[model samples]
Target chain A: EAEVAQSPRYKITEKSQAVAFWCDPISGHATLYWYRQILGQGPELLVQFQDESVVDDSQLPKDRFSAERLKGVDSTLKIQPAELGDSAMYLCASSSRGTGYGEQFFGPGTRLTVL
Target chain B: AQSVAQPEDQVNVAEGNPLTVKCTYSVSGNPYLFWYVQYPNRGLQFLLKYITGDNLVKGSYGFEAEFNKSQTSFHLKKPSALVSDSALYFCAVRDKGGAGGGNKLTFGTGTQLKVEL
Candidate 1:
């Protein structure tokens, strides 16, 4: 089974520094999602993409956070001047097509810690 | 708006016993429900899903979920439990009438299931 791939499984950085996480979805998957999972809480959707076009980014803090799936195959999420509260697991998931009605494959996630 | 509720923060069950993790949802239009499990330092794993079905949906790893339209509930269940089953479980609902093309998934806080051996 093809699984979603993520990089920098663990990261620790200073509060004023920048951090980025990468994700490569399973082949042929057109829908991708970025989520943030805080400690003791469920994951929250930060941004969603459909074939490199952003479908939703209502919850994304655009001033400090940005995500891009240039080719719609791989994506990168970046946070500038990371805050302590941003310390959490950043997960990437992908579905074969639309998100309304199918199972999603999730990557192992990149755990970020800002001190 | 679509929402999922997991009332219990934790559920303890002995190995070999049947186990259940409760989930209730509220949605407009139609309901699409899902259950996922996560171990420490990992991403969420798909366990099961409830779309338009026969009210009973079977999924991976000997797990099943029953959809009760009247109660607006879809609870995860297993015939027998194992210590390895211990993990953080999440229930999610997709917003069928949501903005931005309508595919947003809203999740519950999560429930920790501890299957003791």
Candidate 2:
């Protein structure tokens, strides 16, 4: 089965350090998403991309977080000067279509820990 | 904004017994509901979704969900449970209105299901 790919399954860094995660969506998928999952809470959307353009990033913390999908196939999320509260599981998901009705497929995710 | 709720924090069921996980949603217009499962240290996996047709929707791994419009609920159920079925389940919702031309999903806190031997 075709699946979304994520790199750096686990990451540990001190607070104030910079970290980045990468994701490659399933082939032909046009919509990609970045989400953060706390220990006991469901995932929350950080950003959404349609093709090479950003569709929504209302919930993303602009001051410290940034995400990009230059070619629309692969994406990267970065957090500079990471904070302890930023520790969580970062998930990447993709859907075949950009419509709200399509079901999304997820990647294994990258676990981030800030000391 | 669309939102989802998982009333129960945890549910325990014995193996071979039927199991259910409750979910409710709120949306301005119609809703697109989805159920997802997550194992330890993993990402969310899509289980099923309810769009517009039938009230009962069957999904992967012998799981199913019923959409009740009046009650605004979409609960996940399985006829029989297995030890491997123990995991964290989440319910998510998206408004059909397409407010920002984005397919944003709002997820519930999540429910932990334990299928004991």
Candidate 3:
């Protein structure tokens, strides 16, 4: 069973600092996604990537958050000058294809705690 | 805009009893619904999905979900619940109307099910 891999399962940082999370999707997956799950709320998609390019990032906070998937394999999400409100579980997921409604496989996620 | 709704915040069921976690969705076209389970400190695991065909779709961990188009619901069910089944369950849907193409899934608020022995 190929699993989505994530690094730095836990992270803590003071406000106004920078933080980054990494994700490696399952092999052969063509689409990748980043989601933020706040306390007591469901995961909200922050960005979507098709291969090496970003398809949608409308929900992401442009001033502080950014994500990239280079070579269409591994992805990195970075937060600059993190705020307390930026604390949440950053999840990475991938699907085999962007069409035909394929089910996504998720990573363990990196829990960010900004104080 | 596709969205999923999980009405109950929590559900309690005794071990060996039948269980059901309710889910409803709003979509523009034919819906592709899914159910996922998440344990503490872990990621969401795919359970099952409904794309087309039979309304009853069986999935992992002895779980199943029934799709009711008229009611616009896809509720997860288990014939016999176990203590190991206690976890946070989420329902999701892919936006059929969005122009961003495919592969975007919107999740529900999640339902925490506690199967007590």
Candidate 4:
């Protein structure tokens, strides 16, 4: 089974530093999502991309966070001046189009910690 | 707004015992419900989902869920539990009538399931 790929399984950064995470969705998947999971809470959507265009980013903190899927196959999420509260698991998921309400396949997330 | 609720913070079940992880949801229109499991230091894994037909939906790892529209709940269950089954479970929901073919999922605070040997 093809799986979404993520890099930097763990990251530690000082507050005010910049950090970035990468994700490569399963081949042929058109929809990609980025989520943040707090210690005791379920994941929350940060951004969604359809092909190379952003579909939704209502919950993303645009002031500090930015995400891009330039070629529509791989994506990168970057945070400038990371904060302590930004520490969490950053997850990436993907699903193919044409599948009505397709179930998303998730990648092993990148754990970010800000000190 | 779409939302999900996981009532229990934790559930304990012995190995070989039937286990259940409860979930309830609220949505504006019809709901697309899903169940996911997470192990330590990993991402959420899809378990199953309820779209339209059949109230009962079976998923990976011999797990199943029943969608009760009247109750607005989709609970995950397994006939027998194993020690490896212990993990965090989450329930999520998306409104079927949401705009732009909404794929946004509102997830509930996860429930910790501990299946001891």
Q: Which candidate is the best by DockQ?
A: 3
Error of 2 at A60 (Å): 0.7
Task: Give lDDT tens digits, candidate 1, residues A19-45.
Answer: 999999999988899999999888999
Question: For residues B1-117, could you state the per-residue lDDT of candidate 3 as single tens digits?
Answer: 678999999999999999999999999889999999999989999999999999999999999999999999999999999999999999999876554476678899999999999
Deviating ranges (above 4 Å) for candidate 2: A98-100, B97-100
TM-score of chain B of each: 0.96, 0.95, 0.96, 0.95
Estimate, for each residue in B1-107, the C-alpha lDDT of model 4 and write its tens digit: 77899999999999999999999998888889999999999888999999989999999999999999999899999999999999999999875655336777889
* Clash totals in order: 0, 0, 0, 0
- For candidate 3, what is the TM-score? 0.97
Candidate 1 docking DockQ: 0.73
Give the fraction of reference interface contacts each candidate recovers.
Answer: 0.76, 0.72, 0.72, 0.63
Candidate 2 root-mean-square deviation in Å:
1.2
What is the C-alpha local distance difference test score of candidate 3? 0.92
- What clash pairs does model 1 have? none
Candidate 4 clashing pairs, residues 3+ apart or interchain: none
Residue A65, model 3: lDDT of 93
> What residue pairs clash in candidate 3, if any at all?
none
Docking class of 3: medium
lDDT of 2 by residue, B11-110 (tens): 9999999999999998987788999999998888999999899999999999999999999999999999999999999999974554336477889999
Off by over 4 Å in 3: none
Interface RMSD of each: 1.5, 1.6, 1.3, 1.4
